[model samples]
Target chain A: MVCIMKFDNEKCGYCGACTSVCPNSSLELTENKLIIETDKCDDCKRCSIVCPLGAFLEVEGN
Target chain B: MKYDVIVVGGRIGGSVSSLFASKNDLDVLMIEKQPEIGVPLQCAEATSEETFQTIGIKPSNRYICSEIHGAELHSPDGNHFRMYPHNDEIGYILDRKVFDKSIAIQSAKAGTDIMVKTTVKDLIIREGKVKGVIAKHLGRTMEIEADLVIAADGVGSNVARMAGIDTLFGTKDIGSCVQYKMVGMDVDPNLMQIYFGNEIAPGGYVWIFPNEDGVTNVGVGIRNHKKTAYHYLNKFLSNFEATPVEMNIGGVPLSGTVDKTYTDGLLVVGDAAGHVDPLTGGGIHLTVICAKIAGEVAAEAIKGEDISAEFLKRYEERWNDKVGNVIKKSLKYRKVLDKLNDKELNALAKFMKGRDLDSITSASLLGLVKESPSLVRHLKDII
Candidate 1:
């Protein structure tokens, strides 16, 4: 059970802000697409906080 | 066991060396420390098509991510310049792991024995000339003799140093880098973004290479003297809206090549030789090219039964004649680049904004010095 970050496409601007902040490399951009690797995700929440559009949501209590 | 040539570190350079040696009917053995040939890939894998053609390698779809039409340069102040293909030539970003393994496979087909999970602990030196390597596999250390040994062991090559080749590189000579592979990245499918400024990556730049698989490999590299690369890239990227899915960290030795890449019975190629371009920090093209040179030279030496420093100097001479000037010139540009502040970089961006200038090739960047001739006059010696 690990905490995870999810992206909200509606609020996402596709600016690549969150992907760049992550140190653990849990997040990736695919064809202008953003997908998170759950196993690699440390759930640092840097992505959620850095999203200017407020598109990132944290799933707690994995 | 004895081989005609024993190659250490089976990446592009090592494999290329083995391939050439084997193709020339020399007994070659390639030893790789990694369990898999190209696993846990360490490179960005982008190289010019000219490299592929020269190496006689053709990618089989698994290796190519995007056929780069050109590169887009963005300044800190948001000014931009697009450098289209000068000769309608497209470069490519590859699946490096696959590409490396493919080369090793090809070398095997050409008759080079491939050994993975095998580490070369030290060089077997006698009478001040390299003869072979002391390697370990399956918890057993063994000696493999060879007429010549090719060292392609990447940036921090222990083999190079053990073989009595000096491996000292200046702090300014290295580029530290970090990258993120983000999925669902909504980037312009065609263009690769190169961001330059002191605030972004002093003495270096940030790059966003979009892969065709709906992912973007976002990375930043900076000189060692500047702030930590991760710090700046993380800070600057906080302003964007995309989320990171994966992260990668690596280093590129971006200075000109070492004074000598070859010695008695020894040759160092690729990053081990500091063969990266100073201006663009691109090493793939040179790595493959230098590997080809090392391969050809080692083969010729084996065929002629001459492996002296004088004989092996052929490889050194050949590279200098073809790509040496470009490397020497780029180091000069790197010196000029290190002197620029944020304001100067911003002004540089503003200066070239929307002018439809030529490509950002090595020559074009140096050409900028012509407009401001006095700015880099002190660097004329290296330029």
Candidate 2:
């Protein structure tokens, strides 16, 4: 089992604070969307903790 | 290649560290993940002249975009006060990209090997001692050994965590920031402006800094707010008839220094160590100052053949001695300011209306609380 981070486009402000605070460099914000490289993510939940808009969600996966 | 020191992140802090280490005749290597240094600048680019003097670097025309003479602070109720430096120039608005590159160039000139487009994957820790780094350069993974590793990697520091140091910053401790380089603006070229109002920026403030090229950097920062900094920045920009040339967004760790900045063979400098001021959110000056100390100490450790945490404690001790009290006071002040409502903020501003910048010290704040006993509740910790 593994955990993944998800970005909510509707709620995300795209300020890139989540990306800057992500310890693994797992997140990037483009012009229209927030991209998460699942392979690079260690599921530390830092992005979720730091997102001011509560845009990041944690999901368990196989 | 093995090096006496490995400096990560290649920004002002990393570059300064590399420069100082290499100048002391140590084998230093600086690594940056960016293809080019300082692209997509993340700062409002306002710094004081004293910063350059303290860093022992002369002001260069290549990056000095504007020289500001003074600043104006606008309170929540629209009451404003201006403060000027006793000297001619108060600060400078920088072309951050050029300024950052200049630091990198100086590092190279000081005999430091620089590698760009390189990403540090993890630390090569042996038996709980950091020995080197696992990095990817040009799509190739490699292990680079070093006597000491300096993590100057901004707010989100992978190196610090990889070295078993806690680098977590709570939402309240971090300031979410967004800014735009706007042209065609009608702003005072020599006067920077700061606006403080909960309606404008809930837990933070808005700043308008002008450049010599007729452009202005307009931005806002807030902590743990429902509305993001982008929301506030957009609202602020709407009032100006200006076109945005560039947009920058990032987080600033405003919690002062981390609990620990050094371990065996490792030192965390700059924003990675949370050296930014809690109230103002400025890190460049602190970064340079701390990085210089880190460099000097790392070089001495290498020469002494002692890269233990015991030896590295000098770096922390020296930096704490230099700015620890100031950061402590600023954090206390921020706590007091955060608890005030708009009415209280306005009243405090009114009380401080005729005071100059120097009078904004802790003593004046305590004096204000004395005059208005109602403020005692909020300012008790600060006083």
Candidate 3:
């Protein structure tokens, strides 16, 4: 099972804080927003802490 | 036993006051309650770059984090307002711990003695004039004597209270905030995001500020009516996979200046002065601005040996003139924002869509007010 990733685009500051901490490279900042590459996310939870806006969240459990 | 000026609290406002007082060749003593100068931080640490210019204080590499060009405001109903950079008016979110300590260091360098872990218990008044303070330090009680006392203490200031000033802040006038400092995340290092809504932060907003390295400062502060600043952050983060590195909880005053910030032989600055931005809960800039004024006034009062209420009134007048109008205006704006519901917020967002906004030239936030004219109906009451 894969947890669905949610991104509040408005809360994303495009700081790239999520991408750099994501061990799976699932998070990427593109054009001032955090985009989740669904296949790359391992539900590591790294993206959430580094995300300053609380913009990203996990909707489901794997 | 005697000093020209004594500043209570070692936060931004207190530090600023101490720095200026010492620089002017006055004898100064700065006291911090905590063992460390800036521990258990209480502020969001965001300030406008324009403020730094007025004080001629450059951002040191230690605490200076990311420089933000503009801000994005998000409504709970999937609405957003983004402001872009145009003028030289960029804002910066700082490393608050470092920023605060630097103020103390600067003050010390200017010849002020900073005492840490010194808790002030009460004010020492003589002849109906504020004289000094009684404090406890290192398992011993001591009295610090000074000609004038300046409360650089936080919102619930003991110094102000001890001076017979009403330090009680109504629930409607305060903002409760909770934040996290995460180290493993990455961000643009330039842009900031703010979220608003009943579910997220009622009468207040959530924010994400990115700094240098990989640290990101994320948090929320709702008006006094709302009590879920922490829960909202958790709920909002539930959708994302992340681990907390550090958690911070605090409050910001959003109701404009306190009714009374000064009295005979005593003055208040920083959070104690209630100089925060009523619209957004940002106070560092305003507090420091007022601190500069407070320090100057305190020094002058001490030199003239006239710490009367009328003499100290100068600080209030000077600070009010500098940012009083803007803060007062923002407080009125806050009233409209607090009463807004989801549907109303969406309509306001729709009204602001596609409007060219320059940070300086345009009233970026007022666009929402135009959409909801009901906000204007109470303008007479608010302003």
Candidate 1 docking classification: incorrect
Which residue pairs in model 2 clash with each other?
Answer: none
Instruction: Report the lDDT of model 2 for residue B367.
Output: 73
lDDT of 2: 0.83
lDDT rank order: 2, 1, 3
Residue B183 of model 2, lDDT score: 90
Interface DockQ per candidate: 0.02, 0.26, 0.02
Per-candidate Cα lDDT values, in order, are 0.75, 0.83, 0.74
* lDDT score at residue A20, model 3, on the 0-100 scale: 33
Off by over 4 Å in 1: A1-62, B356-383
Predicted candidate 1 versus true structure: per-residue lDDT over B66-95, tens digit per residue: 878877898777888777765888888888
Can you write out model 2's per-residue Cα lDDT over B304-376, one digit (the tens) per residue?
9999999999999999998888888888899888888777777777776788656677777777776666666
Candidate 1: residue B122 Cα off by (Å): 0.8
Q: Which stretches of candidate 3 lie over 4 Å from their true place?
A: A1-62, B183-187, B357-383
lDDT, residue B366, model 3:
68
TM-score of model 2 (CA atoms): 0.88
Q: What's the distance in Å from true for residue B347, model 1?
A: 1.7
